[model samples]
Target: MPDGQSTRTAMFRVKNLWIIHLLGWVLFMSLPLTIVSREPSAGFPVRILQSGWFSSFFLVYATLFYGNLLVLVPKLYLKQHYVAYAAVFVGLLVAIYFSKPFERLIFRNFRQEQGRELRPEPPREGFREGRPPRPPHGGDARPMPRPNGERAVDFVSLTLFIVVWAVAMAIRISREWRQSERRAILSEAEKAHAELSFFKAQINPHFLFNTLNNIYALAVSSSAHTAPSILKLSQMMRYITEEATENYVPLEDELACLENYVELQKLRLNAKTSLDYEVKGQPEGIRIAPLILMTFVENAFKYGVSNHRESVIRIAVEVAGGDIRFLCQNRIIERNREEERTGVGILNTQKRLDLLYSGFYDFDIHNDGEIFTVKLKLPGR
Candidate 1:
């Protein structure tokens, strides 16, 4: 889905959930009072008007409900301000107690109104001798007797309040935990990307230093192939500087880069050295991390080439069945003692593969007596 549309859908669902909670609370408070009362079968609306707990209980409960959800839990409880949270909680309870008289007054009036409407009195008679006067008819009947205000401070309300508070806290904490996890994941991804970029940036200087040395040797020897080699190097450098910085590049571009390096090396190697290169399958639309294959090819030229004996360098790239395979091998005519030091390019490639492909790629290196080989397989991008 488009991001905007998905976000809007999510918001709509949240709104519906809020509406459901509100309706559910209303029914929860009103249903029992309607069912258990002895009054005649009044419609739901009339019953709600006469209901004892619905009016002020709902008011007080709702006040605390949202207060805890929006304020108390987030600002105090979640912050581990337990003492302050408890103080505020106790204050709300005490306020509920002090609010009892008003709730009773409202309940008494409602009941009286319902009573008068439902049950009218017969004509009143004069008081009997030695008896107090009878209470007046409907207009002035004594209000329903006030029940004990202390009854308001019972276990049921307290338990229900606790349940609501628990729910609010649970919801708030879960949301915070999820948000924290998302932030952590995002942070990790950004850090990995920055590291990969650093690795890529280091490759150009490292590879360029080696290539420049080869160019200097060719320039010193005054080889006729020197100009073309320099041209190829320039093109390769342009590609690296311009396109290699991207997260991915066309697979063909990397293959071209490898070809340039191979041709440059050919100009500097002895005629006895034989080099074989092959590419199979289309590279169209396929993208790969840049400079990933260059290190092994550079290693082949650096330590695998010798003028004293017949040397062979083999490089192949294949793309088929939604996978890419790269292989490079060279006969070890004479190893350069200086090549014992592993270059930074190889280490950078390892780190880049881990950051970008993780377990999705295969990298293998084998060195036996006569030959050194490298093979890499990657899933299609």
Candidate 2:
């Protein structure tokens, strides 16, 4: 994908996440409005909104949710500060519990201001017998009992706090996992790209060295085909420097490059060295990894040619139904010390194949001390 498109996609995903969070919080906060108990009357929603207890509880839960999501989970829990994180969590829980009394006081005062009692007062004892209520003497006044539903309300509120904390932690952990996976995928892609470039660097110079040696031999012998060989070399180098830099090139272009290489090699061969190169494919719309087929062809020419002894090299390519089949066969021959040290191109090409194609392609090599054979099958682009 293009950089601009990728950036736009990332931004779109971020916006979607924000929208999801906003909707989630809205739905969560609206649950209380649905479950609130109140007499049917005008402005019921407004009265509930004006209640100090409702507003206080809403604000407290919202603060706890965001604080845990943004600060506590990432900064403490994810950083492995387990003891500190637990301490902070317990502190917040205690603080919330202690604030309940303040919430009740504010609600009670709000009800008094609205000309209503927080709850109906119990009947006075001995009042039905026409006896005057005894005045509290000194510090002997009895304390009122706690409300019946207060404990249940506190239990429910504390449960909500725990639920919110768990939700925030789960969300943060899941997001972190997704981000780590993305980073790993990107790192792997970059490593493969770097390795492929290194392999190409190795293959390019090695190819030039061998091709130059062939051209040099022809020129030293004052052969008539030397100039034509140089022209083929120029075309091949143009393809390498220009089109081959891309990961994949048009199949026709690769075939043209291979033909140039074969013709260049032919300029240095004798009658005793037999060569056959054939292509049975219409390589128009297909594409292939650049220079992938060259290493095997170069190997054939290097080890299959001789001026004093009979040798054979066969190369073929067949393309059919979104698949390509390539074959190279050459007779094995003894090599000098310098030639024995020169299989870097083949090794690098093998590595490149593994990096680029992996399971998508099949490659086979066989050598029986007389004939060396290579067969490769690749899916088309």
Q: What would the TM-scores of all predictions be?
A: 0.77, 0.83
Each prediction's RMSD to truth: 5.8, 4.7
- Once superposed on the true structure, which residue ranges of model 2 sit more than 4 Å away at CA? 1-11, 30-46, 97-147, 307-309
| Full-model lDDT for every candidate | 0.78, 0.83
Give the poorly placed runs of model 1, Cα more than 4 Å off. Answer: 1-40, 46-55, 86-153, 271-273, 308-311, 331-338, 367-371
Residues 1-381, candidate 2, lDDT per residue (tens digit)? 999999999999999999988898777655555544344246655676687666776777878889999999999999999999999999988876766633353334434444452456676875566554565665544656755324424554566678889998999999999999999999999999999998888888889899999999999999898998899899999999999998899999999999999998888788999998999968889999999999999999988887777999999999999888999999988888886766575778888888888889999999999999999998888
By TM-score, the best candidate is: 2
Residue pairs that clash (backbone atoms under 3 angstroms), model 1: none
Q: Write the per-residue lDDT of candidate 1 for residues 234-308, one digit (tens) a residue.
A: 999999999999878999898899899888887777887788899999998899989989988888887777777
For candidate 1, the clash count comes to 0
lDDT of 1 at 174: 86
